[model samples]
Target chain A: MSSKYSNNLIKSADFIQSLERGLSVIQSFSTEHSTLTVSEAAAITNLSRPAIRRIFLTLESLGYLTSDNGRYALTAKVLSLGYAYLSSKNIWEIAHDPMDELVKQTGESTSISVLDHDEIVYVARIHTKRIMTMSLGVGSRLPAFATSMGQVLLAHLPSEELEEYFEQAILSSYTNHTITDKKQLIKQLEQIRKNGWSLAEQQFEEGLSSVAAPITNRNGEVIAAINISTHTGRNSRKEIKEKLIPLLLQTAQKISEDLARSPHPMNL
Target chain B: MSSKYSNNLIKSADFIQSLERGLSVIQSFSTEHSTLTVSEAAAITNLSRPAIRRIFLTLESLGYLTSDNGRYALTAKVLSLGYAYLSSKNIWEIAHDPMDELVKQTGESTSISVLDHDEIVYVARIHTKRIMTMSLGVGSRLPAFATSMGQVLLAHLPSEELEEYFEQAILSSYTNHTITDKKQLIKQLEQIRKNGWSLAEQQFEEGLSSVAAPITNRNGEVIAAINISTHTGRNSRKEIKEKLIPLLLQTAQKISEDLARSPHPMNL
Candidate 1:
């Protein structure tokens, strides 16, 4: 992590290290550490006390961070950054009702995710119930090689990009059912690309199963993936494929059509 | 706006102007301007093209922004910042089911918002249907003095803060029912605080009405407000007050309880 941070610093003469440090300071506040002292932030970001202090002060002045009794925490202004990303895409607006309908039909958690490097970042979601051991939400990420949505997205990437990804990705064994073998994963990706959907049963986590379909743009380029995730104990793999995949596919098509119709296609 | 921007730059010796400018550049990209040229960004931010170009290049290198045929656009990596904010709060996670229940029971749009300066920033939302002229999602901002959630939040502020707000607020007239007079607004706030909830009839937009209640922390200080917004044409103010207020208040109390039970209360 430190090496990558320094690499970014050296990548460009104009790369603002202070900006990076300031964002890191904001990111340091998490569910476990909502409030942090300068020392704590410094420790997390591996920056100097003065550096952290300056960043904290600047953020506080901007109303993105607030200090109370020497402990710094993020304010609602920080949410605006997320809002910018979400509102720009307008995916939530388009996917809202469709996700709700999917959740209602499946009686399971439904989400839409986009590929970010080697991970799938969930952008929109509607939960029927908490079915996963790891809590997931709008911003949660999972390994791209092991999950249904990730595979669906990865399957749609250009061949050269897919090859580049295969070369760089670390296919760690997340569960007993995880496809850690590169060749096997590549084969699955090919099948998913041809079939227009992907399914994973206990690949990333034990007992969690999901079926995902690609959402395309007007040009038919895969822009995002939508999925319905459920527990394996409640429904067998065949049951999910039979019961949920059709609804999931229909919803993805609807979102894709909406995206095509929207005036702001680049935002999606 | 330019004066305020410069004022922040001059506030502290340690204030990172480059950091602020970099973030502003990111925030400049919106649904309307998802992709921006260096000159376009410079025009919006009042910064030089060279400075904007450097920031854009730096952001692209960091994977938060990408250059496509000379136009820079945000990547999914940008969503991580918002994710950091949303994940830290855990409010959406806690409120998801309850908000869904509220939407189901009331058949209206339900949302939770927190006061930010003179605006209310939506943090979590569950929509039954589109009810307003404007489309709203998490991270959307509404005038605090004109919306039911905003009024509920404003009503609970400390007297000194409320006085300061009243003194500084512009009290723009969004609709005929919008509270434009500071004195009248204060009187209404007093009634809302006393009643433990607020109801606004077409205060923000025509044919829109809402009922809101404060969600307090374990310390009994109001941290957020949750509301149910409906079309006034479909339901009368008395009907909303008699039916939705009870459920809205109950949901807010439930969320408040869950927030108090959370390990990290500062984020809420």
Candidate 2:
């Protein structure tokens, strides 16, 4: 096939600026604004409506975005691009087998998530037959204070970094059981470090409870966390602590072993 | 956040040209060539080595790519950019539930895949207890003729477009079971239209079998295919025909029902 448009942007740095703008246009849509009219995109990106329309047209042409009734949103093509990233990165490849095994052993909804800025982004999820009440996905993100994965990852932070986290703002409560206070969250994180696991009961959202333990590398550095979420009505804290905790820790250990063995350098 | 540098490429189309060059530099690496030296990137993209080096430096600073031992490749940060694309889409939200039900009914692995040029790209996959030996992944692609999903999608093509597919080049055989003859392949696609599903046994790869059925909207246009892949050792062609065919058809029906019920138009 002809490689007409499939070469490097090496002539000038101008392409870098356009590339950044294109990415920014894509970043404009979120949970709050799933679909937006062209004018709305113009307002959101602060680009002229005409410019936004052209970018939308190009994106749509590229099969990354789609539009209807004057509104534009992303398409499954974007997911393939994400898949490209995930598939190329050996982290998911190595982490998934252990995750699947963990679900088999624990009979709980297990997910592996990494910190992305302020929120915990789920990279992989393994759902047991018993898990049906709550819905979670690979790209799903939740607040750091309200999810077990978030707490365990937070627990690994240095003391100075922890202080900077608290200085940002008040933690908004998702449920009455959520830790909204910064100091209270810090205390909980410290306790999580001591226990080597985190349990969030009715914290992120009511009726949902989860337990998470950090997955570390050979250096004993926490890179991600594995969590199992069950409905609050299904299991007690003591039962989960006894039954699920050992399995989660074992899974984390197996993952760490795999990570250390492969040492596959990530190429995104 | 401020929307800085959000203009369309038309304002400075020269910048768009440069962006294309930069992207070419990034896209030069693949599964086969995960890491490359500056001269290799220049050779692959047909750009000067110094120009490639500067773009590489900028991309490394941008956290998109990384370098070590004078070899450069992408990083995990690329997943974030691709995830940005997925977070902006709503189709997966519409498609996820039906997919779960499909997996529940069929013990085989099922996925929703779309056409990206000549290759069929898996957008989503629902895997059950059985370990999939094949490397077919979310962003993974395969020759359309060698895959059931690809055939179902190919059947939807117009006559001229179908001719374009035939005109392309020799059909590379992935397995002894793969269909290489154009005349026979065309007949099989016609059979898929009559039978309402496409089945392939070790066509794409050895020791794997799959059946794919099309998911259409109210307009009766095929948008995507629902497929179930199982190990050849686990089931024979006769067993698959009797047990899996009906279940596969049912899953396709469920996806179609959900597709019809969706309020948003199927722009993809």
Candidate 3:
């Protein structure tokens, strides 16, 4: 209790608030509301119209936002910030080479992704041409439960964290194969933890199946997950288990070893 | 001058110094100096130690900058800002299908890049197996002259703008084939404009070749450029010109057509 008082007494100035409010305004935007009138943004952030407009103008001048007619939208210049994170000599770069090797040997669409709140964001991908399918890339995010990468990453979390996740997340079915039940998902994660790998058949998208394994650090903690995606119609789960699993596991192990050796962070 | 003065300036109670100082600190940490001590940040931004310490702590709390072992660096959370931009319908969703189709047909690395000052930044890439040899993704930046996409995009600029660019850019040689001379680059851009596509052979990197065409809006002004990259050892310029030229040009045309067909920004 004394420590809490001391923490509050540490006058960090109003600097953090300004930064947070700026970011909060940015976070107000998403796939659903890509473009917003100034008034709408003000409503979303609970900031005054003048405050939001100032931030918007600053962002637009910096090339992170663009306006046409009356509405403002984000521009690709904003990617530079994320690129700074994803391109750091950290986890994504370490796992990339091994991912390439895995794709070479197995010819499967391999990717390394990390958990972001309730979503799974792909940070790297070694795409194979056998399947002409959905759009996926580094920086692409999807529902955590619907991805093989998500299950393996989720399996590593403590029970308390899992419960908190369930409390926050909505388990909407993306495909017929997607697990909608919260209890079933918890059980599946447990199985994934025991098996050291995860196979999600048509979970995220119909006819698109994937298998994933956790990439651990020196402390044996899961930092990220690596996966191979393919069409279920082209290959069976058994074939993936027998042929792709070992290679996938080896890639995961190689990435884990690399993580243990390197001093840089995986995602940061 | 009258129109410029007519532009509304929004006044916000938000602390502008806090935001500017924080961003300056983030921008200070580049690839060269990813880790900086508080003193280093203070020196870089010409802010006092107490002010910088507060800024760093605030940024760390917001997940933009992380402090550890007496050094500060950016975090993956900073990417959320950029991800918000890519989530916009104008760029990511609109360009996804065409990029995929371009990759399918060309069997080369296809990317959607936009101009950021004198350089071109990759906003998205639909990479083929062979092209996966390199690491380039959303936010990756490269000099415009050394890339086909850069050349095509530069071709879109007015002659005075091109001269100003040459004045500002260092024009260093990334490869032996890179155009270091300003006159030569201007001539090349002019050809790219006349022919409707640009080819870069061993320009950005030795043994890598690429072709790019511009994507324009209904106004016939280039808004972005799409490129196809491949290994120079695998194919000749003639092969790319004969095979990929048509595909690249058609893809750009398609994206432009889509942009044209879409409702005007004012309507939205």
Candidate 4:
């Protein structure tokens, strides 16, 4: 099989197509398609009916997927896989107190997110108030070009990887303020790198705004980004810059210092 | 391949062994073993080195696993699997406000947990005060017999299933107060079922006390349990029973009511 991801370097001999297919079957059950039939899963995964049937049976047998009548849905066992990743990273636990403190000080939702492909995945979050229309939570993903956390993380990426990302990204506009142009996004990223932070105003959603800073490891590599999200209606750009950004940066720095001091390595 | 779980009724012909093996590889990475070599993964999963190599490569290619030198670790992409399960159940979002309210009212940590085999996996949590030594988060698992949520969940299980659980359960003692005896546990479960709530005092961890109530679906079958956990040093048993339990039960009832009123089914 051909590699879909450009970063994948493993030889064909080492790759297992069946395992990937099985994971795809599990991924097929999302919010939109919570319960799926065998044929529905087959269609979603683009696998043969026999293949999807086997995958479903395998997942159901393992207790990750449960069958209700003719439809299949994921059970709580699937959470264990994500928990394994979250528990492995001491960063979430280390940043918890600091994130909470940031929320307390700013009275806004504070989150720590890591760069994954073209999106940023929130790993730790503490909400002081829910101001955004979108229901943001741990494990939620947002496009790297449209969100403050994503911009901070993208700003710190290796030059070649960033260039490749720019070459391949779709850059779809969510709002009129969103940077859909590659040249403009690159310029924004460069400015964010120089400023050591980012403030995105109504980029991803109509009234959503956030200020973010990179959280580095002991090696000073930006492993994740932390942000304070507020509403455009509640807080003006000037007020957010003056009040929230400093506290957000301070909390990010404290978390970075704590991460550096931690004996356990922050699993990126 | 033979089925490891008795409840798995799918024929061996339908079960995809490779899929099971692949999931096992993912499961092998935990808090203790965050990064694993091919040989280490092989040993943990009881699969051959070649099999582990293929699984690792497939996972890496899918962006779920990343390799550094000879060690493999999970990336943020893996969180999407857990997010799929979480997003499927709007209950977490629905319960968020009530849980926050409970935490505010009692000044304790509030959580919702669902039974996964012999363990209760925390699905949602809101911490007002950090009282426990153990760092508890969403997806953290605790023994079903030792935790208040676990007891409430176990109490609501059908008679045959509960009997089978008692028969197979190790019932290991976490603290001296933990009820490890089968007969005594059965009696306690009976009382919990009758009372519609449970209060576990220093059962799982010394000084860690919690009161839990079952959250049922429209069918009135106990799908999950919600609890308010406090420290024994902070509040007496009488105070918790009188004050926290009522609030806990009310929140659970409200959640249940909302769940019943919801158009979408709770995918348990």
Candidate 5:
């Protein structure tokens, strides 16, 4: 394993390096690199072909992966891993109806996502009439400095963690509208924190715009954020701010209330 | 490890037992058992508490899991493992529009699922105004003999695999209407294979009904099944047969056509 994953736990004797290698190998296969040779996995994971082969054999034996023509790819059994997370969270079941209603009311797609380091991971999504050029669905990740949901989540982070995020995150300019400067992004996050919602116009993608509202837990901590996304061609920034933010805020509150009432809220 | 998972591959020297243990440890936390202690995981996986602790530490280090006090639960980062599967399949992307259109046309929820052994795992779903009592969504599993999509998939399975399924699967009658007899199920499968469509009326659950059609690949072989579901209270068998199956078939065909044309149709 590379020093990239080097940390106290990984360095400790109790931490299973094989488990980390296995996960890294699994993650190496992405939308771009859907299928990979053992050599390819070796290159991506910085491990030898023999080591990658053993991991691949183990995963194939476990039904998480399959290989044909010397190219290995993940199987549907791997989905159970994601299910473990989604089902454990139990937020999707409670948030589904309100999100569906939001989609109906707005005639746009809406999703719920939570912050993870420098990115936000979409937990649940309700799609309506959308022809998304950049396909964002459940389990999709976007930079926290660009998307509306990411901004809402970042705005709610504690001071120490937010500082850590800035320290680690690159804040690359994804588009002309992307806030590349840390101070500017932090200031915008402060404004979003005050407003309790955010609107990102062509920040992540040129024609894409979105507005997000924080979904709080019972203790009023922003556990996640919900967003309504529209094409810039279909919606004006002023219109999304004036019309959708209120409804998005209402839906977010409804989901938050449902989550609070839920007897089993998976503490992230 | 249980002899339950005993196979030739597991016995091989090349298989990584730790990787299998880690996956089993992860799978141990499901919707029912959302949170677990080291002792609980040890009991569930038949591993020692020390071993479970090590695995937990490893998973936490990898960000696939988290813990509070002594209780451990999966983290959203685990979603990426499942994303590897979904994104690799590339079917969900092509199936989305057609499945969404099917939901709109039928005024009900629609889903696509693939057969895994005796169960069907949902890969894609589009919900409209669904009040699902059983809570079937992406990555959810249902017994193949009890669900419409399952029957459609079971009907198309190769003879050797079908025989193995019958040998391995516990033919539990989930509901009063569930087909339990192997001979009767085989006969029904034969008919479903001939008919090219299926209507499962309250077999899996009372007051729930669904109709399904197969989605074929480039070879015209059934790769998956798509179904439209509604509450039995809302629709009678005759009405569903007359109204929904044609649309379901059409939707399945459209998705199949799209899958065939798409550069990447994941070979199951």
Candidate 6:
């Protein structure tokens, strides 16, 4: 909904169609289809087979893809593209120590993420638990409507922006606990804004609960959010409220204070 | 050097110039240049200002780039691109527990990486110490010849392939302790092949020491390597050999066993 200007840009003579198609092909590969044939890629991306083949060959030549017989799998060089954004931000340098300390204090998995469109993308993570059913990492994404960090991020959005988000976001239920009703979700976000923190009990995944606090910039605008995630059986809601929430808020505040000291984002 | 066939592929009509240029622009933004103006990007990429402006506009339209006046920075959508490769491999699900255990056992930083074109790209990691100068993460890359993981991975390469590696690799010195001499480097590889592990003391970085072991596939081919990295001053050379080496080797072996149990990589 926010990218309506992209329609005009897509029509511009300067817009690169081949680049979009090439990235589309790369995105086509997933857990279910780690490798794909030219035909499979064409069918998935709605490109011609010849066009898909050429893109695959170009990617393979560039060391971003590997060909095994006729099927093409992505190479590790793809990591460089995503890492560019993270490295530019110096996220690991800033977030690792604080998140690691939070994990040590809470003995739960901790993560930091920024709001990306309708989802939240994890930029940094410190996992203390090995047995979480959710096997998430740095690039993992979760629906903004169904996770504590997402709620915190969404809560910080300007009212009109939040309205646009609610209008466009697909409120699909991941679990029975997920808030799919728009009105109900709005109430939760209002409460989160007032409380300065949020909790999601098995909303994203069954038997998992997490509490999150907003991370802000120098001007006190929310830039990102961090969470302490735990299994519901291990940490009851009462203990989470009494024990983990305070530590989570303190870590979030500490990280925000550090971000305030950074020079580049000061202009914001 | 290995991409001679790519020259012919580049000549093909199927090769997409726009795709390559777009990716190059994305790669140009780094720690030093977190954001770039059109002029700066054109200079770095050697594209015309008009062409660069169009590409930047296209990237911004695609939600891959964010613009403030004339300066542009990458957005988190780029994370999804690099994450595609990591998610396809399910790296965290397999490596996290073992790496966490290794960090606990050794009280040091531990990481797993795969060899990508003579460089080791970190695939998984666990951190216990707070003050290591190396602020590393999943997508970090380091020269293979100068680091323990790189050495272990290189040691497992076929003889001709190893020769080709030596033929093309840039053996520039990172520190005074680096083994830039080819004869000496080959001798060390031979010993590492026999010893089934590697230790690099202040080669890649000053005051850092690491010991690594190969993680093999089900068929006994080395696929990746894991390392226990610590301060050379904190753990003496002799103490590293006597204490950390055995624990590091055991952790690597445990990971190799778990990897062997997987069914997909069995075909390798």
Best model per TM-score:
4
Better of 3 and 5 by DockQ: 5
On lDDT, the leading prediction is 4
Scored against the true structure, residue B244 in model 6 reaches a CA lDDT of 89
The sequence of per-residue lDDT tens digits that candidate 4 reaches over residues B146-239 is 9999999999887877877777778998899999988899999999999999999999999899999999998998989999888887988788
Fill in the DockQ of model 1: 0.38
Q: Once superposed on the true structure, which residue ranges of model 3 sit more than 4 Å away at CA?
A: A1-15, A104-107, A130-136, A170-187, A201-209, A230-237, A265-268, B1-15, B24-51, B65-75, B92-107, B130-135, B175-177, B230-243, B263-268
- Error (Å) of candidate 2 at residue A40 is 2.9
Highest DockQ against the true fold, candidate: 4
Correct interface contacts retained, every candidate: 0.46, 0.23, 0.34, 0.56, 0.54, 0.49
Q: Assess every candidate by TM-score.
A: 0.88, 0.83, 0.83, 0.93, 0.90, 0.89
Q: Which ten residues in a row have the lowest lDDT in candidate 4 chain B?
A: B129-138
Ranking by DockQ: 4, 6, 5, 1, 3, 2
Candidate order by decreasing TM-score? 4, 5, 6, 1, 2, 3
Local lDDT at B122 for model 6: 77
**Per-residue lDDT value at A21 in model 6:** 86
Q: After superposing candidate 4, which stretches have Cα over 4 Å from the reference?
A: A1-5, A129-136, A264-266, B1-6, B129-135
Judged by whole-model lDDT over C-alpha atoms, candidate 5 comes out at 0.80
Tens digit of per-residue lDDT, candidate 2, span A1-268: 1111123334565235555666577768765667778899889989988767767766655556666677777665555544544554565568668877776776677877876446777666666762221123655667777899999988997666556556653588788998987778888998999999999999988999999999877667787898988998788888898888888888888887787676454322
Which residue pairs in candidate 6 have backbone atoms (N, alpha carbon, C) closer than 3 angstroms, thus clashing? none
State the TM-score, rounded to 2 decimals, of chain A in model 5: 0.91
TM-score of chain B of each: 0.90, 0.84, 0.84, 0.94, 0.91, 0.89
DockQ of 6: 0.45
Interface RMSD of 3: 5.2
Query: How many backbone clashes does every candidate have?
Result: 0, 8, 1, 0, 0, 0
Q: Which stretches of candidate 6 lie over 4 Å from their true place?
A: A1-11, A129-135, A233-243, A266-268, B1-11, B129-135, B233-243, B250-254, B257-261, B265-268
Candidate with more favorable, higher DockQ: 2 or 6: 6
